[model samples]
Target: MQTIWAPWRITYILGEKEQGCFLCQKARQVEHDEENFVLCRKTHAFVLMNVYPYNNGHLMIAPYAHVSSLTELHHDQLEDMFRLAQLCESVLTLVMQPEGFNIGINLGKVAGAGVEDHLHLHIVPRWNGDTNYMTTIADTRIIPQQLEETCELLRSGFLLEQKER
Candidate 1:
């Protein structure tokens, strides 16, 4: 059997899970944006990198409201979320140059929603040959870049894009 060393995962495995919604916590803590990996914030929504990402430039666009369903959001919130999704795609494309993107929302826990209570859209950047045998054979996905480094790149990209707008 081949062993893969993922030393960082131990923090999540052994650390005590904080009470209350993590998304809400992150949303409220605007001062801690860098520590929380928040790339951009809009009037009604924000964009941040996925700590447990499926790919290198994976991002999530979420509203400030802590509603489980999209129906609960006002039209402005929904619009803001979608606009942030576009921003995520643009920033990722500029920084990572992905060939394509997979963008969608998982509504429930059974639907692959990691934070089901707060509806968010995922923007996963893809490239040719990004998926390898390790995914099917070992049931593991490899992310090439460090989360902090990716966050820095994406954050810079977002700033540059927004400034040009």
Candidate 2:
């Protein structure tokens, strides 16, 4: 069997997991936005890159409130989250030029929510032939760009986008 060298994953595998909601932690740590991979912050929600992404430009829009489901969010929070989703799509389109996008929220653990307690929307950019043998056969998804670089690009993109508004 051919081995894939993904040394970065070792940090996540061996690192001590932090307690409490990571999204909430990130939300509170505004000064650490770059380290947290936060691209944009709305009034009630924020957009950040997925550290374990399904695709290179994968992003998550999450409310500041620690709510398990959408029903728990105030209308303003829910609206802000969706607006952040639009911002994610716009910035990803400008920077990555993806042909398509997959945007949704996984409401529960059984429905594929990794962080089941925090309500978040995922925006995964897609291109033709993005899925290949590596994913279908080896069950490994390849992300082409480094997270820091992507974060910087998207952060700039979001800034430019906000400036135009």
Model 2 lDDT per residue over 1-165, tens place: 778888778988999997899999999999999998988888999999999999998999889999999889999998998888877888999999999999999989899999998988999999999999999988898888788899889988998989987
lDDT for predicted candidate 1 compared with the true structure? 0.90
Query: Where does model 1 exceed 4 Å of error?
Result: none
Across 45-163, the per-residue lDDT of candidate 1 in tens digits comes to 99888899999989988899999999999999999998888788888899999999999999999998877798888899999999999999888999888898998888889989999
TM-score for predicted model 1 compared with the true structure: 0.96
In angstroms, the error of model 2 at 97 is 0.3
lDDT of each: 0.90, 0.91
